[model samples]
Every structure is written in C-alpha cells, then in structure tokens.
Target chain A: MSRKYAAKGIFLLLLVNLLLCIFYVSAGAVNISPADMFHAFLGDGKAEYQNILVHVRLPRMAACVLTGSGLAVSGAVIQNVLQNPLAGPNIIGVNAGAGLAVVLCSALFPYCYAVVPFAAFAGAFGAMLFIYALARKTGASRMTLIMAGVCVNSLLNAMADAVHILWDDTLTSAYGFRLGGFSSVNGKVLLPAGILILLVTAAVFLLEKELEVLTLGETVASSVGLHTTFFQFLFLLLAAALAGASVSIAGLLGFVGLLAPHISRRIVGEECRFMLPFCALFGAFLVLLCDLLARTVWAPYEMPTGILLSFLGAPFFLHLLLGRSRRRRKKHD
Target chain B: MIRCENLSAGYGEGAVIHDISWEAAEGRLTAIVGPNGSGKSTLLKSVIGQTSVERGGVYLEGKPLKQWRHKEMAKQIAYLPQSRNDASLSVFRMVLHGRFPYLAFPRRYTQKDEETVIRELKRMGISELREKPVSELSGGEKQRAYLAMALVQGAPVLLLDEPTTYLDLSAQMELMELLRQLVAEGKTVVAVLHDLNHALQYADEMVLLENGGLKQCGTSKEILQSGVLEDVFRVRIHILQDQYGKEYYGFSSEKRMRNETGPAASGHPKRLQIRS
Candidate 1:
C-alpha cells in the first residue's frame, strides 16, 4: 500500500476512536443529554451538571477506554514477544505481582495508599526481571519464558494469599482488584492512570515492527539486526509497566486484555500495526459496554465487569484455542 | 567472502567444531558434510556471530564476525537454520521477516521489500499459501517458506542447515534445484545436505567435517569420492554408476564398532553436515 493510503487508513481509525470516546461519555447511569454533555464538554457554567456529566461519567469512561486499549495493546505485544496464544495480559503475572506488592505495602504500611501503584510497579518489574533472567540468558525462548511466567504467577499469588491471611480486613479491596472490575475507580484516580496508559501504548505502536520481527524466533530476529535481547527487555518492561498501571487502577479485569487483541487480529489481519490500534479500541469498548451492563442489568447493585467479561470471554477463549487449530489445517491445505 | 579461521565452538568447558579454518568465496555454493555433533551447524552459526560457545570468531568480508553489526551481516549473509518450533505467523508475514534487518522503528515494509517477498514466495512455489497460517503448512511447504524467507533476506551469502532434512525424494530434488538456481543467479548458497547424491547434483563444492574437524574441502566430484567418504564416515561405501552416468553411493555396515568405543564415537550420523 502507498504511504498516502496507509495514512488515510490510520486517520480513519483515529476518527472512529474519537467518536467512540464521545459516545462512551453520552451513555451511563446519570442519563446526561448529548447537548448538556457537549455543553459540559465546552465548560458550560453549571457546577452540579458539570459534576454529574463531566466529573463523574467522562473520566471513568475515559479510564475504561484507555485502560482497555492499553491493556489489550500490551497483551498483543506480549503474545508476539512470547509466541504463545495463552499469553494474555497477566501472562507474566504482572497484575499478580503488582497485586502482591500493593497488598503487602498497603497492609504492612497502612498509611501508603499512594505507594500502592508504585509498589505494584516494583513488584511487576521484579517479577519480569526474575523471569527474563531465569528463562532468557542471551536470547528469549518461548516455552522457557512462558514456563517462567507461570511459575512466577503461582509464586506471587501465593505471596498475595499470605499477605491477605495476615491482614484479613484489608483483603476485600485487594481481592476485588484481583478479580479485575472497574467500579472502584473515580475521576480522581482514573484521569492520571488513563494518561499514563495512553502514552505507554503509543510507545508500543512505535515498536510494532520490531516486535513483529522478534516474533519469528530470536535467532532470526538477531540475524536481521533487531537487537533481540535489547528489544526483548524493552518490550517486556513496557508491557509490564502498562499492565502494572492498569492493575493498580482497575484491579484485574481479565478478558479485555486477552480477548481484545485476538479478536482484532482476526478482524484487522495479523500485522502488528493493524492489530494494535483496533485491539486498543475494542478493548476499551468491551470494558465500557460491559460496565454499562453491570450497572444497568441489576440497577443500584453492580456486578463486577470482570465477572461479566469472563462469562462471555470463556467461550471465545475456548473457541480460539480449539477451533483455530482444526480450521487452520483445512484452510492451509 | 566468508572466512572461519581457527574457529572453536561448543558448550561450556569443551569444544565441538575445534580449530576449523575454511573460506567460502563470493558467488560459490559450499556444502558442509559431517557426522552428528561434528559442529557443522556451530561453524555456520559462528560466521553469523550467533554461537554461544564461540572460542574464536569467524570473519565476514574483512571484519571479525563479532565486530560487524548483525544487520550489516544480515544484509550480506542470510541464514536458514534447521526447523525446530513452528511459528504462528502467516506465510506472507514469515517471508516479510526477511526484510526485518532493513526496517527501523514503526517498521512498515517498503514497496521494495514487499516486492522481493512476493517474488521470493513465487520462486519458492508458496505464493498460493501466502495468506494461510505458516504452522498449518506441510513439512515440504514449510521448508519452502523457510527458503523463501532466506531468499528474501537478499543477502549475497546464504547458509542453510539441512535444507532437506525430512523431505521426500521429489521435495528433496525440488529444494536442491532451488539452491542450484540461486547459485546460478550468482548468489552464494551454502546448504547442509544429508544425501550425498543430492549434494553431488547441486553443490559446486563440499567441505567434509567429521568429529569436529574438517576432513576435506574441495569440488563435489573430488569430495564425493569413495576414499574421502570413508575417511569422514568410517563406513564402507560402494559407488555404483547409473545408466545416466551419475555416481550413486550407498553406506554398507560391516565393522561392529558399537562395543569398542563411547556412544558419541559409535553412532551413525544423520546429517553429514548441517550448516546454519
């Protein structure tokens, strides 16, 4: 394709993403009219109206979209870098590691709410460091990396459980986040988290091609001047950072990260550039729509969107795992 | 030109392909033949600066292999290593990976790269499978795709490790013919071949390596001779000429050496040589 055509395609995607953001703002529990939403959008001078529409709904919605996109993009990156279909958002236990750290820090240092995200960040980074060090010496091997990730995930979860056992009262928030629902986040927490996710995911877009090359096994990647080791560490760090941030704010919403990218891959083609952006949009939409369902389905009482997602995502995951293999054989021949 | 001087490689504390010195001239096909664990693959890997057990470096052009940037080396030497894991990529994308060395950040393929990938897909006879998932392809089809990726790298020096490892007779002939055509186009193609007859048909030259040592390096006609074959293989080989005047050789087992030595020493090798 020509450069002009590709640019136009990307511009169209951006336009659509923007439109979705607007729609997301317009839909919610408060039932704010689009005119008033737009008025609030334009900084209309009604404090109560602005608080209901802009302060409450818009930021949470933005958080859903950005986190959804961010986590999904990171999932796509992880899937390619590790070369495993099962390599979803928490494949490396980033969420668990972060959860463990947050729980430990929050429980042990009760006055450290701000440090929770940072603790999670440190925990996630530490877990990745351990996995990469153990599994990857010079080059990253797929099975070794996945095996290491699974081990770290189990170990960290155990530690998280240990922390919960010690501080049983604070365990509610910790466990809630671990299941990965988005209800707890307000505008105050969501805004900053959203910005961070957007920036990091943008960086992932930049590294798309490098990641694609890295997918073809490390030996080939190095032969082609991809700096396999450097890129390996770079991608893992970036994916973990974004995922850590997502976990800190939203807890452990499972399906958005894992399912979004796979669905987008089937839709937009396997090329990383095509897959990443669509995955991001779909991720956000899925979470927001699910959250909308959670709130309205049992009005005044909310089901965790994570629970709703798993209800839907489980079947899709099974189909992707089982059906793809058999269908692929017939199609290729 | 590619040169390996005093090259030694193996796992920690020991060496496999030891103190080997050889050169692959520009625009020539050189096949490496050796016993199992003889380190033909290691020797080829050292040339690309990939071997973890490198005691000494291989040089490309005039620079030490390690000194040259991997992308620079890739622009010169493309490699097709043995098949191990199946990638969950498309055939088109697999070939596109050959152009990876030329891509920078935001790494979209250029028109030129795309054209080469397309041309190579056709050349390797996998053009129809371009959109199909790579893992779903048959073994021969997979090997062909592997060859296409190497070809798409567009490097002057090519190294293939056992290009026909599991191929049937026709598929084996097909791959050999592809290599021959590559050499005819003035591209240097070095493939590790197990079948001596296949090597004899396609390889302009052969480097026989046995027990981590270079036994002989010369023209295929000279290296495929009964005396040289026996020296590297330590097996009785009877050469019979076909009606088409082609020399066909077979290995005959006579000496019972299994009880006389270590496991490594007594085993019959599958790959006479396996270059990277």
Candidate 2:
C-alpha cells in the first residue's frame, strides 16, 4: 500500500482501538454503567464496578492485546522463514501440532490442564521441524506440508476421539476446551504463556535482520555467514512457542496467525520492523473487537469468541487472499 | 590468498568436485566457465561450506574454514547465488542483509551498516530504487541490488554465479566495468559465467571447468584461446582480435550446425587434425 494510506489506516485503527477499549469495558453479563466505568477509571468507583473493572475486564483486555500481538508476529515470522505466503503457525501445522498436544493431554489423563500446554508446545515444535525437513526434501512443499499437518491433526483427533469413547467421562468433562474459546484464563497457565510470548517476540524482533537475510535462500544466507540451520530453528521455535502458548490458553483461535501478519504487511509494508509490530497491534485489536462483539452483539448471551472471529475475520481474510491474486494478475497487465 | 585444498562436493552419497586444488589470489577477477552441470555452483557452495565437502576444506589467509565460525567466513568470503526471480525485497534491505554475518549475539543492525548499504547502492547507481520493492525492478536493477548485497557482506573474495545472466546489452557492459573497478580497488571477484565474451573482456584470469573438474586454469590470454575453448567445451571455435588488440571468439556458425548432426562426418575438414 502507499505509505500515506498506511499511515492513515494505522491512525484510524488506533482511534478505533481506544474506542473499543472503552466500549468493551462497559459490556458484559452485568451491563455496567459507562458513568461507573468513568469512576473506575478515576479510581473511585463502587465495589462492584471496581471488582468488574479490575478482575474481569482488565485481564481479558490484556489477553486480547497479548494474544493479538503474539499470533500476528508469529504469522509474519513463520511466513518469512518458510518463504511462503500461506505459511503460518495456524495455517500450516504449528497450531494443529499444538492442538494435537492439547488433545493428547486432555485424552491421556483427566487431571492436568497445565501439562496440556507443554504438550501443545512440543507438538507445535515437532510440526515446524517436519515442515522444514519436508520442504528441503521436495523443494517448497508448502501445500504438502499443510496437507501433512491436516493428516496429522486428523489422526491425532481420531486418537482423541478413541480416548474420548473409552473414557466417556473425560470427553464430556473437558468439552468446553475442545470447542475453542477464551472463557477462562487461569493465572498459572496464562501468566507464563504471556511472559513466554513476550520473550519470544523480543527475540524475533532481535533476529529480524538475520530473518531478512534468510529469505534470500539457504546458500545465499550461508555465504553471507548466517548459520541458516540454526536461524531456521530459531524462527520455527518462536512460532511454535507463541502459538502453543496461546492455544493452550485459548484453544485454536484459527487463521489469525496467518491473516493478521499478511494484513499488517500490506498496511505497513514488508520491513519486519513495521510488519511485526503492526501485525501484533492489529491482531490484538481484531481479537479484542471480536471478543467484545461476542459479549455485546447478541446482548446478554455470549457467542464463543472463536465463532465470532470466524464470522468477522474470514471475509476479511478472503478479501486479502483474492486481493493478493488480483495483484499478481495486474502486475503484468 | 583464498585456498581450496583437495576440496570435494556432493550430496547424499555422490561427490561432484573431487579433490580439487586451487588458490584465488587477492585482487584478481577469476572467471570460471563450464558446460551445463559441470558443478560450478557446487564448487562455490562447497567453498563457503554450504554443501558438505566430505574430503577437504577452504582456507582464508592460512586459517581453515572450520577453525573460524560461520560469521567469520561471511566477513571473508561473500557468495552471490544465481539470481532468483521471485522475492519481494526493497533495494535498501537487500543490501543491508549483507551485514548479517557481522551482527553480534543479540543482533541489531547498526547505523554504519545502513551507511555502507547506501554507499553500495550509490556505487551501483541504484540509490534511486532504495525503497522500491525488488519485484518491480528491471533486470539490471536486480543485478545491482544483489551485487550491493555482496558488497555489504564486506568480503575480500566475492563469488558470483552468472552475475550478468539477465542483463541487457548496456547493463552487461556496465556491470563488467563495475567489476573491473572493484578489482582495481583490491577486491577479488570469482564469477561463473557461460558468456565467453564477458570472460575475455574483463577477467584477469579464467578457468575452464568440464565434467566436474578443471580442464585449464591460466590467464585470459592463455586460457581463452579457441583451441583450448574447443577442447574444454566440446565444440570448435575461432578467435578474432578486436580493435583494442585483445582476442575474442565466436563459433563458426555453419561448422557448429554440421558438427551437431553426427559423432563424425566422413568429409569434415581437419577431422584427423582435431583430437576427439
């Protein structure tokens, strides 16, 4: 996009974000008053308002922001590392791997929510390794990699189902997680995941220059003295850690990891300096807006945040995908 | 000197370059020419330790390639791959990646790196396209951008694969002139090229590669003779001296067509004189 237009777009989004933050805090089951929200902001609200603001609203808002940045930056990094437009933690196998891990934990034992995420992290890491190795073998096997991810997901899912069938009590008990939502955020799981994402994100930004060199291809990257093997592993790890951690807290947000960064790149430009940060912000805004709508759009009865995201994010995602195609066509004409 | 002592290249059980020994002197533009699949690119990759050379290794100033780490190699030898047509990089960032090997553990690009990149873009005359995405650039612009990246690598020995493959007439001449200028400034450039005319015009030295080994290695005056080229390339060629008193060659066009049809023709001129 034109730089002027991108600047304008970002400015407008920032304004919308401020409005959404205000509006989101006022929304929920209790239907708190905006005037009371102002009091809470001014540090002199009533007990209930303070309780809602401090406990319920702030953490969720922070989650929106954190998850947004995590998924978006994760997507951008994955795409560049894989050298494929469609490559990301969600669209490729990383999320599936994480999801598989979560399902595995949920299946194997009936007692540990925390271990599910570690399982998720391991699964995501494995998936990324598979993709990299598969690509080197076949020369740009993105579609095949995605296919491999899907197959792995299905097979794990069947394992999950079989476990569910055998242990019928377990299946019915952990059903909420399998469906995907942000209904619960335990500090034990949530805090570490949050900190992990931040650390990984910092590392990614730090490696931005090396990542840029990496996209030039392995031989070129190596000739210039980059440890291409290690760099590839670094990016793959970053994507896995972020996605696995996020999915553990919020089950399978789906495509935000792919969609967010690409949109950020289009809006801001391909400099990772611009792309990574903008993707993170816009991604957070997208998730927050969806979560807010999940609470308010139907009024008093909340939709799953995943379903709400699908309703809003999919059209935008399709528009971008088709937009990319139209662009390639126009470049010639 | 950049030395390759008994260097070998292969992947998964087959070696292409076998025990090859050579040294590229500093400040010399050495051109390597070979037929298709003569393992020129393989040799370049192996020199930088891109491909696993199972038998031998490269040395820069008497230190083994393995003794110094990857980043150290980057500081010494820069390799430019054959140009890829599909990638989106701005001219500015493309050159900036050349600074990759120099960045420390918590790597951050320094302002000095930017200055060096801009300096290269200026030298290449593509400073105007600094912000333009690489996809939109003309053939010459892309070549310059890649060359700028190699310069950013800050290596004494610059290895390029077909640096002029996609260029137009004037662009080719301009790139050759730039390379000559680089050699004058005490940088060594090793290029793999198919164009004999380019090698004859600018290279200080030339090496002919055939069937995964060096056929002849010498000065351009010695190595570029029609007889040597014919022996190396498996085709007859004739030489002509240009107005500048330097030799150049062209295939005898009719003779080339006639030679393409058979292993040997009964009535061909000097059939006995030519070694098969």
Candidate 3:
C-alpha cells in the first residue's frame, strides 16, 4: 500500500476508535446519554448514571482497549519473530499458559489481585520460550511450529480444566473467564496489567527497526551486526508479557491477536514502523466493536466478548487456512 | 587485511575445512574456487565468524576475530551469504539497514543514512526500485540491491559467497565487473566462485581448495601455470586468446576428453584457438 493511502486508512481507523469509545461508554444496558456519559466522566451527573459509568463501563472500556492492543501487537510480533503467519498467542498456547497461571494463582492466592498479572507473565513467557526452544531444537518448519503450539495449547488448557474441576469455587465465574468477557474487569486488576501493556507496547515500537532487521533471517541479521538470538528472545519476552497481562484481565480471548495484525498488514504494508501502531489501533477497534456487540446486540442479557470474537474470528481463520492451502496447491501445480 | 592462521572450522562438532592458513590482501579481489563440497563457502563463512573455529582463529586488521563486538565487526567487514531472505521491505529500507550498526537507541535512519542508501542505489542503477519490495524484484536486480546494501555498509572489506549463482551470463559479467570496481576503489574483496573461468579472468589472486584443504593460493597465472588446477579438477585447460588478443581460460571435462581430443574436438574455428 502507498504511504498516503495507508495514512488515510490509519486516520479513518483512529476516528472510528474514538467514535467507538464514545458509543461504548454511552450505549450500555441502561443506555446513558452521550451528554450524561461525558458529564459522568467530569464528576457531574445523576448518581446512578455516574455510578454505572464510573465503576463499570469505564473500566470495561479500558479493558477492551488494553486487551485488544496488547494481543494484537503480540500477534504481530510473534508472526514476524517466528516467521510464521499462523502463529498467535491463542494458537501458540500463550493465552492458555496465562489462563493456566491465572487459575492456579486464584486457587492458591484466593484473595490477592496484584499477583495474577505477574503469574500470568511468568506462565506466558515460559510457554513462548518452550515453544521457541522446541522449534529451534527440532529445526521446525512452518507447520511444525503450529503443531507444537496445538500440542502445548491443548495440554495447558486441559491442565487448567483439571484445576477448575478439582476446585469448583476457585473461580468466581469460570465460564466467563474461559469465554473472555470484560464484565468482571475492575480497576484494581486493570491498572497493573494496563501499565504493563502500555510500557511493553512502547518498548516494541522503539525496537521496530531491530525487529525489521530480524525478519531478514538469522544469517543476514547476524551478518548485519544484529544480535539475533538476543533480539529474538527479547521480542518473544515482550510478546509474552503483552499476551499474559491482557489475559490477566480478559480471559483467554482467542482471535484478537490473530485477526488484528493480519487486518493491519492488509491496510499498511508489513513494515514494523507502520504495522505495529496500525495493528494496535485495529486491534483496539475490533475488541471495542465486539464488546459493543456483546453488550448491545443482546441487550441487558450480555454475552461474553470471546463468543462474539470467535464468531467473527473463526471464519477469518478458516479463510486464511483455505487460502494458504489453495496457494500452496497452485504453486505445486 | 583478513588473515586466517591454521584455521580449522565448521558447524557444530565437525570441521569442514582444516588447518588452512590464507591471507586476503588489501584492495585485491581474491576468489576461492573449488569443486562442489570442497569447503569454499565454509572458508568464506569463517572470515565473518560464522563457523566454529576448532583449532585456530581469523584475524581482522591484526586483532582477533573474537575480540571485536558484532557492531564493531560489522563496521569493518561486510559479508554477503549465498542465500538471502525475500524480505517484504522496500528496496530503500532494505539497503538503509546497512546503517544499523551506527544507529543508537531507537535505531532511526538519519538523513546521511538515507543519502548513502540513495547514492548506493544510484550506483547500482536501481534508484527507480527504491520503493519496490525486494521480494518482487528479478534475480539480478535483487543481487544488485543486496550489493547496494553491502556497499552502503561502507566497510573496507567485503566478502561474498556465490554472488553470481542465480544471475544470467550478462548479469554475472556485470557483477564481476562491479566487484573489480570495488577492488579498484581500494576495498578488499574476497568471493567464493564456482566458475573457474571467472576466477581466472577476474581475480587478482586465487585460493584453490580440493577436498577441504588448500591446494594453492597465488596469482591466476601462477595457479594456472602450476597445473594443480588440472590435477585436482581432472580436466584439461586451454589458455585461449580472444580476437582482441586478451587471454581467457577454458576447460574440457574428462567425459569430453574421453571421446574428443585436441582443439578440433572442442569444435571451434582456428581463429579462436591459440594453444593446445
């Protein structure tokens, strides 16, 4: 895509994001007017309107943006770093890792809220490094990496299930966590994870050039004086941190990581400088859009954002798979 | 100058080239030539610290290869490997990555870096390709763009492995001429070549390898006169002169030698034949 066209698309996406933010705060179960919502934000509205907007919708909105941008940027980083378009936090067991950690932490800590993000980070980072190490050791191909992810993902999710089944009351709402709704998100949980996501995403942007060099592959990257191993590890660390922290707030959200970056790649070219920010914006937009649909589409009886995401994301994933296979078949032909 | 002393190196736990000592002088185009699997590529790779040196070490400007950090080494030596990734970056962005070692914190490309990239692109006749993705370029054009990238690195020593592999005959000639130009401009260039004729025609010095060991390292005339090329390759060479009276090397394979003999068997007119 040309720079001017890409710039236009980005501006449009940003505009949509802003409009969605306003609509998200306004069009909830009780339907606070835009005027009331703005007044609530400024500490002058009806007591009920102020309470719902301040306590519930605002934090949920923040969770949506944080989870969206975090997972999307993580997806972009994993795709580029691993040289696999199919790899995402959800696909590659990263969210499952965080999910398992969150479950375990809840089962163990019971009362502590601050420990979940760190626990999730550790879990996600471990899973990423394990998968990466396995790939390196086996000299894995594109398909093999996905296969490894599937294996790790299934095992971790099963372990989390075993934990949930063994201790019933350990989770306040196990289904909601699994399906990834922002309904349970509170300020205490969102604050630390939000700070983490913002800092890590900023760090990723700073390393955009280094990440670009890494896409040149190991030999060329090393030849050009890039510490390939170190950078690869570092990027994976950032990717894990983003995915884990997001999962801490929003339960195993499946496709934002996969869908957002791919969509951003289509709009802007894959230059990290452009792709990273675009992916973040598009990711935030997709989640906010899905969350809005989750709450308003059903009205009063809300569905989990994960269900809506899967509804939108699964078909896109299938299309990607079929398209890739068709292209491979054409090449073979 | 790159000097390897008693170097035995290879990938993990095995040495492909053993106990080899060679020197590539300043401002000379040295070609390493050998048959397939004879470790010519490995020898070139060792200079850039790509291989595990089992016994000895490579010295760049009298300092040990291990002593220089990656960025410091990159500023001194530009190495181009045999295979490259088809990156989806624009040609200008791809080449501007040559300035990676110089940039600090955020690694943003400066105006000087952009100017250097543009100059190298113009030098390579690919200024129009600056915005095009490298993956979309032709084989020869991609090679030139990569060469431009290496040039923008502004290193004194350039190492290339099979740079002419995927190029056409004309493109091969152009690349060889460019290497000569680089050498003439006082850059030390060492290339691994497969074509012995190109080695003989263009190289200031030739390092001949046979079965992962150095057979000879000398000027083209010395290597040609020494007969080691014929002995190791098991092919007869004809030092032919063109119509312009400039000399070039030609060879006949052993399979051809079995069925055909002399200059007539090679099937050319008398004007093309200068020696048997």
Candidate 4:
C-alpha cells in the first residue's frame, strides 16, 4: 500500500518537475512557447529560440536542478550522519564556508572561474571538519553541534563580508552570486556542477544502507559491523562536495537543503533509497518553482533565490526547533 | 571462547575497567553484576573492543580482538548497548540491520537475511509488531525488538549491557529467560545485570566487579559462597529458599539503618529488599 503511494508520489513529483522545467523555460524574459521549448528539447527549434533556450534558460535550469538536488541530498546525508533533524549545509556552515571561499577566490584571482568551485569544495570540507572538531570538543550533543555550526557559519560569513569590504571593486560581479541566484549560470558552471552532482548523488545512493544504520547512532552502528568512523568521514566528504558545488553555482541557497529532505522524509519515510531520489526531485521542483516566481513575480525586477528561501525557511526552522524542544519536554514529563 | 587477558580499557584519559582477566565459556550465560559506577558496562564493552585498551588485550576464539576485521568480529559477537537512540525505524527494518556484517558493499539484504529477520521477530514474540515503528512500542516491546535485532546477527557470542534496566518485573524475567534459551541453543551470552537475584537465578556463571576491578568470576554458586557481593555492594544479604528449593538472594540496609537509628532500632523488624 505504502509502495503504491511511493510510486504515485514519485510520478507526481516527476510530472511537477517536468511541468516546472517547461514553465521556467517558456515563461522567462524571451517568452519561448511550449512548442518552441519542445522543439528546443528535440534540437530543431528556430535558431534564435533554440539559442535562448539552449544557451541561457537550459543551463540556468540545469544549474537549478543540480544545485537544488545536491543541497537537498547533502542535507539528508548530514542529518543522518549527525542524527540531528536540523543539521544541513546552510545551518551547519557548509554553504557559508563555500561562499567565503568563492568570495576569496574572486577577490584574489579575479575571472578564474574553475578555481572558485574547487576552493568552495575545499572550504566546505574545512568548515565541516571545523564544526566536527568543535562539536567533539564540546561532547557532540545535538545542541552543542548546532551551536558549533552557528559559530562557524557566522565566522565564515563575516569573513566573506570582510572580503567584500576590502575588495569593493569586485563586489558588483560577486554580489549576485553571493546572494545565490541562477542569473550568472552558464555552460561553464552548469557542466561541472552537473557532473559532480550526478557522481555524489550516486555515491550517496550506494551508501544508503550505511546511512540508515548510522541513524541508529554510533555505538549501535559500530556494533553492527559498520566502520562508523570511516563511513562518517566518507559521508561528510560527499556532503561537503555536494554542498560546495551547489554553493558555487547558487551562492548560499539556504533552506532547500533543510526543507526538501524533511518534506521527502515525511512523504517517503527515512529509507534513503526512496528518500534520496525523492529529495532530489522535490528539491529541483521547489527551486524551479521558486525561481519561476522570482522571475515573473514583479516582472523586470528579480528577487534573489537565497532571499526567497530564507523567507520560506526561517519559520519552518523555528517550528522544528520549538517542536523538538517541546517533544523533549514531553518525554521528560 | 572469549577471553580478556589483564584487559585494561577506558575512555579518553583513565581506565574504567583495570587489568581484568576473565573468560566466558561457550554455551553458557555469564552475568556481570555490580553496584552503580562499578564498571560493569565498561568491562562488557571492552570485551567487544568498543572501549580504548590502555593495556593488555581481548581474544575471540584464539586471535587477538584487534586482529579480527570488524565484520569478522561482528559475525562472531553481537552486542547490545544499555540504551539506544530512539531511531524511528520499523521493527522488521531494525532487525534486518543485524545482517549488515554479512552483506557486502552496496549492502542489499538477501532472501536469507529477510528470513532470519522474520525468524528473529517470531522468536522474540514481536512478529505481530514487525511493521510497527520502534519508537511507538512499550519499553518491554522496544527491548524485545532490540534483542531481535541482536539475535538476527546469528553470532555465537552475545553481549548485552543491562538488558533489563527499564523493564518491569515480568518483562525482566521474560528477557532473562529468553537469554537463557539462547544459551540453551548453544550461544554464549554475557549480560551486565543490576539485579543480583536475577543474575544468580538466570546466569550459569557470574562475574562480580567492584570499583573497576574484578572481584570474582565463577559459577553463581561459587560467587555466592565467596561473600563478595556483600563486601562489594556494602549491604547485608540473606538467602531464602522456595518450596521447590530454588534459592533467592534478598538484600537489606538494616545495618546502616540501625547505625543511623541507634541501638533502639534492633527490635524493629528489618525491611528486606526482595528482587525477583
């Protein structure tokens, strides 16, 4: 029965994702029709329509899908590894760290696009390690880990702000990316991000069993013959890669990481085999929908995707926080 | 055949169980009993290589525990901690995790694994709750579910820490009897128990620990005769026999109570703390 629901859920999500993709492609600044979008998809559209769809909208859409899926899957993996419902790339400092690295690369080595993503990846990994170290030092409780993430996030964000202030001339180019939108996305960013997302998402799928066992907590996971330390490190590395790649493309898109996996888990239980793919599709659909609104809402003016996400995500984050505390209080009673 | 040779282990800086040499023979239920903070759980954890060894080592079969691959060790020894995180997994899925050691990378459970999980659920009397989330179960039911998970590992050696801690009287007895049945089926079971009477009644052999040290290791009868329980726990105990001649150990804080209340408290009946 649940399997049937799961199938229906997947089908519905795919349909929504397809429709959103078409809407995003067709309703943009150039207003390509559904026929033209279909023709572009088939590689036989009119030349100008094909160029607009292929070169501009398609890469932007691909960036949205890749970044959205990567962040959401990374969020799911981090939440499992840390055993904290609130843990994710943005809250846990991975995106801030990546953003800091991107800002630093842009300031120091202007126009070197390839170096930015790698730096972002390295920064994300470093931030994860930093948060882990802090959590370990403080006994790694849920509250302590989140607190550590907050500290790392603030520190990295401040550093990025400092870089912006110090190198004010580069701010114009770096500002939009920092706020996280698909405006700057082209084949250069999309291609590499797409490949990395595919690889890491597959890798996460392969680690599905380990991730599920890990949700049982470290002691039980280790006792059950999982090399808990090794797998934790590997999962963290994969999460960092995913989050870092997404941050490079989308520039600190918050909440999708936290929001999408959570919604997927609610729809399909915690089994990663089902949840992971669902999270990816759900995440893509969400970002595409949000981006479509961002584009068409006020016409010529566009809201940054990150700002829209924060507005949507903050209340949800607070709700989870309060709900967790309330549950803990009830358990005590 | 699990043996600890002067095994000294602990967390970060200090050894919790120091230089404890003990052996759990095959096909017997061995209970490690001690007062709170006596390192009973630490000793059990050390046996499974969960603790940091400061000195000496543990051996499973004949090989040093460190030499055994984690998967190989998991195939031989199954361990259950005193407490587990409230993971929201179904009973069937939770039990299936026991097959992790047997499954290779891209770890998909096989037909045999599913069968074993089902069998364990039935054996633990939780087959009806296979689809139920563990978090929704009663304390006793949760313990049974965890036990089912451990049993499905199919290991010859089972180590459980305070398996009956949060259970009611009947649930405690049921779990102990289940462990005994496992022993009867040729599995070696080592459990850390807080209830001395339960340990005495259910364990074939008992190890008594006091202040991070091994005080006794022998048959329950031998440990009873050794008079270590009173000394280690700092309480006086009396042995009572039922009509069937089954002996039960009962504890009293009478001596301390008398000291506090003075000589006038002597004629008053002493309260017996009976644990069944």
Each prediction's TM-score versus the true structure: 0.85, 0.90, 0.95, 0.95
Q: Give per-residue CA lDDT, model 3, range B1-276, as digits (tens).
A: 699999999987699998899999789999999999999999988999988899989999899998989988999999888888889888988899988888875457889999999999998899999999998999888888888888898999999989897789988998899999998899999999999889989999999998889989999778887777877787777777866789877777756776675433322211245654
**Superposition TM-score, candidate 2 onto the true structure:** 0.90
In order of DockQ, best first, we have 3, 4, 2, 1
**Which consecutive 10 residues in model 1 chain B have the weakest lDDT in total?**
B267-276
Candidate 3, DockQ to 2 decimals? 0.77
iRMS, model 3 (angstroms) = 0.8
lDDT of each: 0.75, 0.76, 0.89, 0.86
Report the lDDT tens digits of candidate 2 across residue range A1-333.
555666677777778788888788888887777898888878888888888888888778877777777877888888888887777676666776787777667667646755765777788898778877878877756557667656666665566566667767667635555555666765556777788888988888777777777777777777777788898988888888888888877777877887787778777777776667677778888888888887777867777787876666667767766877798799788
Docking class of 2: medium
Q: Which regions of candidate 1 fall more than 4 Å away from where they truly are? A: A1-24, A43-46, A104-118, A137-151, A161-172, A186-191, A314-333, B11-13, B104-107, B238-276
lDDT of 4 by residue, A127-222 (tens): 998887676566788887888899889999989989988999767866786678887775665667678888999999887889999999888898
Residue-level lDDT for B203 in candidate 3: 95
**Interface CA RMSD of each prediction in angstroms:** 1.7, 1.6, 0.8, 0.7
lDDT of 1 by residue, A1-333 (tens): 323454455567667767766666666665666787778768873666688765566667766777777778878877877676666767667667877877787688876556555666677778767766765554555545666777888889888888888898667786677777767774544555566677888888888878877878887777777788888889988877777777777877776667988887766666777777777877877787787787667866878877888888878777776776777697799
Model 3 over residues A65-126: C-alpha lDDT tens digits? 99999999999999889988889999989999999999998988877888888899999999
Query: Considering TM-score, where higher is better, how would the candidates rank from best to worst?
Result: 3, 4, 2, 1
Clashing pairs in 3: none
Q: What is the interface RMSD of candidate 2, in Å?
A: 1.6
lDDT at position A300, candidate 1 = 68
Tens-digit lDDT string for candidate 2 (B229-262): 6656655455555555555555544455577765
